[model samples]
Target: MTISSQSARDLTANITALSDKSVALMHQRSMSDEAVTTFQNILQKVQEIHDPKAALRSLSAEELDVVRQAHSLAESINISVLSDEGAANLLNAPGHTKDLNNDGLTTIGEGNMLTFPPDNAPASFKAAWEEASDGLSTMDIPTHMIFAVGLANIGREPGDLNWVNPYASPDYDYGAAVSEIIESVEYQYNHNMMSFEQYQKNMSFYNTLTEALA
Candidate 1:
């Protein structure tokens, strides 16, 4: 489930936008009915996936076991993207191997400009890009998977694995491990481990996910 450099940047940008929106929503003391409903739905989805206590009990035994394992692995990561203390580490995350413009286009980097062309990205690269984007966009994934994928995107490129983790210089494949956990969540979803209501809750579970991880 490792992500390519381009995918990593794109996912990070998307998550950042979501986080920004969450923050904005939090500042409003009185929100419109629609806004309140949206907020509640998001929060419920997040709780469903990230909260063990609130997990859907409808899943098969095997699915539940796998979900537990993935949840445990997700819980072990200590990096908190929300805290000021942890923010520096996040900001210093390694750059992508390829060039990513603020406008969401991926490219190849040179001295001052980026080169954009179909040939610049091979079929494999394009396929991986599509897969990562599609997987992340799905409502079936948990918040842990989202963070894991983002981390994977940090170093999933062909040669970028060498520079993946700043904290642990070598020997660890955090991205791969996290991606597996994400896949496990998907497996649980496919297996009906949780009800649609519970699966739906994880969409807004970022706050709960952050809190649980904290």
Candidate 2:
């Protein structure tokens, strides 16, 4: 089903207000344990929805809307608060890179690959790329999907490239697909590819939902 533009706008507004309130609470509480636990629970709920690729099929429209808003919020949180060092560590972590080649990279479809920044890349670029890549990997989806979404965030359209999934699939998992899309959004925000207002919108959406859910 398609969401109308007005409905989408209204949903965004509601989610944004919720996020604003949550952030205010966090600021007021200085991220106390209670506040942190609440945030973690909300994130856990989002992760649970995205972890099973098939779970999405059962959701109602309202549930799906919440899922979409939550995904955006999760992306913002991952991009804004997840540190470069944290991201790099996840990429280089033992067992994480087993799928990667000697250079710590893996290919997705559409002639795109996710990799640790080369030594020649600027330090800032390397850090951001690693962070984005790391965040993408944490989604517990196929590596290829993660790569495609990351590329998409950078303005590379997988459909335009006639991208083919390298992994065997009965069907594309919608939950995983959405997870990747959210990761790509995080990548864009982390890299400053999105406008500040856009970034704030995402963060507010995420923070507020997190607060309310907490």
Prediction 2 global C-alpha lDDT: 0.35
lDDT of 2 by residue, 35-144 (tens): 43444344333333321222333444444333333322222123223222222222121112111211223321112235433323345443443443443335322243
Q: Give candidate 1's whole-model lDDT.
A: 0.34
Taking all chains together, the TM-score of candidate 2 against the true structure is: 0.20
lDDT of 1 by residue, 63-115 (tens): 33332232222232222212221211122111222232221122221111212
Task: Please report how far candidate 1 places residue 85 from its true position, in Å.
Answer: 11
lDDT of 1 at 64: 32
- In terms of lDDT, the best-performing candidate is 2
Give the Cα lDDT of each candidate: 0.34, 0.35
Measured by TM-score, how close is model 1 to the native structure? 0.19
Please give the distance, in angstroms, between residue 62's alpha carbon in candidate 1 and its true position after superposition: 60
